[model samples]
Target: MAKTLSVAPKQPQSCAALLEKLSSVLPKGHQFGIYHLSTPPTKTDALCHPPPDQRPDRTYCENHFLAVTIKSESKPSSSEPHADWRPVIVLALEIFIFTTAYSSIFFVSKADSTGYLHLLNLPKGTPSPIREVSSAFLAYLIDKRRRKGIQTTVNLFARAQDQYLFPGSIKNGGKHVLDDRGLVKWWCRVLDPLLEEQQQKQGSPWQVVKGYLLIPGLDHYETRAFIPRTATSAANWVLGHPLEKISHYCQEYDWVPPRCLIPKYPDDPKSRYRDELDEEASNKEQNSGAWRSVKTLEQFWEMMSFRQECSSGRMTGFIWVVFDPKDAEVNRGRVGGTPMPNGTPDQAPPGTPSRNRHALSSATPKSSPKKTFGSPSKQADLGRVEQKKKAKDKKKKKKILKGPIIPRQPRIKTRQRNYLVDRPVSSAYYYWPAEGRGQKIVDESDYKRCTELLLRLDFATLDKAAGSTRRWIEEVGMGSQWGLDVQGKMEMPPAAQGSGTAAGVVNNLSGLVRKKPIEGSEGQGQNGAGVNMLGAGLVRKKRKESTDGAEPNTDGSSHPAPSTAEEPKVNMLGAGMVRKKPKLA
Candidate 1:
């Protein structure tokens, strides 16, 4: 019965002042009507429940005004409809914490260990083609090229590992330094082959160049001899890495190596090499825009020319003249003292003179397989027999292939239903006529066939038939709205002729003829028959068929009349086509 106080939600004051007034204003049960304080402009509704009998009557006394203030510092309810207030302290504190965290932290990927975490922007489940293709290419190269020299072999192995393991890491300044023990293990395993090759060629020109190449100006004068056919084979296996991955990585990174050195022929002067280098620089950069490397081993192999069991090619900047085991059948068997199978000629060691004296005594003669065949004269006969067998096979193949029948697969028929067709004739093409009278529902087979036919017909006819069909469609509660008959040539029948109600008649007839439409005498009436005849007339008219055969029953079903209906006098629309009406009994 006390006045309802519209106290603005709790207003804030200093802590001490709030406490001093608490006792005086605390509500009801105990000392005062005081409650918590909040900021200005908020509504504070005091929760006033009816005083219970257990409490004193002083609690009901309205004089104890509860200071139930709405505080700005209180947390908001998650379910609250609207809370727009943000205190200055909260805003300042949030900004301070965010700035502190952001400055102290850097984002790290969950895939940091995989080295390809940067490619997360790419869609998940997409495989990296580069890694697989490069690895396959490496295996193929090694199996084909057997590099002998330790230095070249070790470098090739190192390059392969670099390409496969880290891929694009080298271009980004990642050092290739291995741990102390790892370095020793690598040198022993990979470097031993090259060192032994070096040792074998100690007194040769290889040793001379090895020492002189380390000196200053003489470095330019040092000659690089032809890589032994064996050595070249091994070098090709390692080239796959540079060709496949490095080109793309370097091209993207803009880290393409410059062509600073030029190779000279064995007899060409050091001056000539330097001169060609200068001319190359002066030629306005012939190799600047295009890729200077082959970019792929497949390209290298395609460009290769073979010279006596070895394949070699100059790919823009670098010249790799090499041999591979796969390239020659004879060399594969002969390398490393492996014996050639019988009937293959063995080349005498580089420059050894023929030891005819030792060969004659050591030779062991045996009769040839041909000599043992029956008689000496029969050898020629046996050769003829083999030749005739080959000819017979050729003749047999020709006869069988002369006119062999190849059965072609039969094509499955698929009819395209054009739902978007806007033709008048298409409307009736796939139409489902209304259920027969007295039948509760349409026959399933009939309905399915009709639906399918509608699905297959041309769009234009469907467009024309749609008008009559649309009404049938609705009455039947069929699948869709009547397709548009954009041509608008659908005409009212002569029975419904000149009647202002022809449109409604057409709608009724169309509905009746629509498959599964309700069976009743409604569309069978005179109005419905007139509309149906009109539609049939339009179809016959379009095809230039005689409308003479079409007659509408009292039920509006269109049936072909064999010359029984009387023709009404009508205007001639065109050749042999007259607009006429049937005699109604």
Candidate 2:
């Protein structure tokens, strides 16, 4: 008979122990347990009603025990075997969720309903297309600046909004929800040049009109939308450098006269303390010599670089300069040469080996010292630094001689293409001093014709805001004959052809014209019969000439020439006679 074995059941661990044990055994892929809880089947009940053998796991409870089961990966498999890349699937899902959330934040924060409408109107799944279009637009702006030898920063979103919105709306606007902080800052960079141009035009004898920086955007409360920069920074950005770095560059370079001269040795040992003397001497030398006179901006840069190089002791001649091994490899197996760093120059830097200087010449200046393991490398470094300094100075001087490498002003590229709206063009026409002449009104007929032509012209452009000139012409009431006729109302002829509004306008114009000689006194003549006839004729002639294009020569033979001694002084009482007695009278 087989030895009797006790069938005692294994003891259950405490809930805490069981939980810890379960957590450890469960693979990350299998962390999820059963989907829901249900009443457990008792051991006796299982005997009466057999349990379903298809359950994945035979879970145990106080009343029952169950067996573990394996799951099939797929419903249909060719070989009845499938690979479950659970880890990969789980990782991918996590990444998808994270990416979606991140992208949503950028779009959802401040987007206007109109913006969404616009997005919807776009061909479905158009973000990719829009991005392409935007990229192209940005590239065009960049290329435009480049072609003009300028650098600028542009924000496509802001430009797009500007194209759609009216200037007054933008100016007196509330906050926009979709203003991206980065994009706004970028816009400021682009607009730097325009602000600079404004500053230059209206010389800041007092305060300058800083710039039109939008104060409210999505984060208006956090950061101001627009800010002005020094003219230098503006110019730099227009030329394509980052605005933040522009100021740092300006501070580094001090302006003065230029001369490439050897450093002078002091006359005494105490020369170290003679900075004041050196400054005075330097100034005096610079002031006296034509060589030192720096006329252009480039020369100022050269002078500054020269000063720095000299003071830094990097101006010593020919020392072998080794860059990293990678640079050496790039230079075609050469280990050392001068590193000629300079301001923007199209040519290859000086001290570069392509110009044919021996690599051995990169050795440092000879100084007597003990032959030690560490010394040569240290000497080599010193040599390289000295070489770098001289090379830098040479490059700087070359840049200076090139003359005003940076343009004096920057240009602001217009926003994206748009059609102008709402605005109309108008003008105030009257005679004033001509180009060093007496005065003449512009051709009223021609002006009227231009106004009419403008009013009827079509302005369906890709850039609506950009087509503002069209709007300006329209809003200002500058158009064809009709527009001019309306303006003519301000000074209607004594006889108006039409009645009602047009006639009223013509009457108004007549009134304005009749208001008279302003503060100036009228012409006078003798009181005799001859003077009366002459004065009446003159008055009538002037009135007729005002409307008709009857400009007369100043030296017309109608008036008598002045006698040299008496100089034909006007009679004060007659000259003081005013025209068009005031209505108040």
Candidate 3:
């Protein structure tokens, strides 16, 4: 073979080069800008920042954008304006992270989409620019919060849609665009890498991510707004995504976890945002518990389908990044002196005198010995002894509660986990959940082959883009390194190629979902010859003629007589073809 030229991946694109590249790839007059809410809100102008986030931490993730655009007349002739790379208007897609009252508690609120996305008229598929910018900002928040020793959880919704801005998107979903279901998988792929990165570090407390789906009419009947005497119905339905990757991840943590989805407390501003905007409904749900009548997490998602957002034409997905620390006490098991679930120390039964204090205790006045005639000094000594005993009892009661002891009912008033048990870090109380041996796959070779290969190629330069298109096809299409779980073969070095969009077929979903294959189907199968029958072929089956004068049929059945004339055995052309009957005068 002629000496093969090695083609390496191009260096990372710089900010300036990236801006220019994005400007060219994206439509004219559009800029790929990023804006985020500044902490303390005071740093950002009032236009970008809103009122207080109603959070104790003084952190607000939502900020509106001014619909400002650069006119062609005012646009700079040179690339000087792109040098700063700072956004004048940030399209804020809000993701709030409120630490709630405790670590066990988390909040995921959904509001109307206030993002200034009108500027972006890109085609279908969640663009990498949007994904990267949004993910990076949230990742920064999570990292910042985690560094401060706060538990971090991420949340997002999945609703596959064509370009919300472009008018042509309605007619053309564009090629290779992901659908609603695929969007769920795509997002998981996008975020899974982040979770893995965190895992490789000091260990990410979040090990699981669950997606709750809402499909109206298909899941449950329409969730009509009706008043109930009791809070017996729930608006939060829980039809989770059917992706094995997430299900397996969840299994590793809680095999059959309690279906406790998002909690919708009465008038809870943090949980119900968009729905609570209706003052009448807010007050009604406040009184009726938001119709939160679902008994399990699964039911919550089923009910969610009835919402206007997830009506007959739309589907909504709610995702949660679950945080469960590995150092949870489940592995070591609770040691002695572990306080009960309540803030109070492990209780002694009411019948047990050693732990329980009853009315018959000696501390009561009735238990005191009757006053008897005695010296004045002896009577004074007895009174002083009673006072000392009372003081000692008071001291013991104070020790029972390490801090303020608030009695709570199950989910309502439960104390934090580990109670008073000590840990390496005082704030590290994440020792929670079961210790079952969940399915653990240490090897990530499949992740590299399956997940990593599915990412979109970077298109910093035009020539590189065409070459990458071919390289992606050759490496991925051929299964150059084979097998699902086994280590793939060595990656083939990139070969030299001419510029221009690579000429090849691109297989896609074709606006159809893949289902289980028939027993034998040439039309289906991923590895089948990429061919389809054009309406089951053009020819008709041969027709049989009926006998005019028929012989008497036997009990079994009469059969057609065999041809008596015989010919010399010889290979003949058109021997089996049916000939048309000739017409004669």
Per-residue lDDT tens digits for candidate 3, residues 210-283, read 32333334533332221111232132223434322222112222211112124332223223532432243444
Q: On residues 540-582, what C-alpha lDDT tens digit does candidate 1 reach at each position?
A: 3212234557543456446565464455556445544665788
Off by over 4 Å in 2: 1-120, 128-135, 145-176, 179-473, 476-585
**Worst ten in a row by lDDT for model 2:** 89-98
Tens digits of per-residue lDDT for model 2 on 1-585?
111233222322112322232233222222211100011111111101011111111111110000011121332432223644110000000000000100100000111111111211222222222222222222222222121111122211232232121222233222233233444454455335433443465432212212223221113233332333453643332221122221111112221111211111212111221232235455444333213244323333334324422233321110000011112222221112222233223332232112111321333112211121121123445676899999999887754355557757877878832111111111111111111110111232433353344334322321222133335334433342111100001222334323323324334465457544323235443342333335632352221122346554465457543243242245333443656666873
TM-score of each: 0.15, 0.17, 0.34
lDDT of 1 at 18: 29
* Candidate 1 lDDT: 0.24
Which candidate has the highest lDDT of all? 3
Clashes of 3: 14
Candidate 3, run of 10 with poorest lDDT: 46-55
Clash number for each model: 49, 39, 14
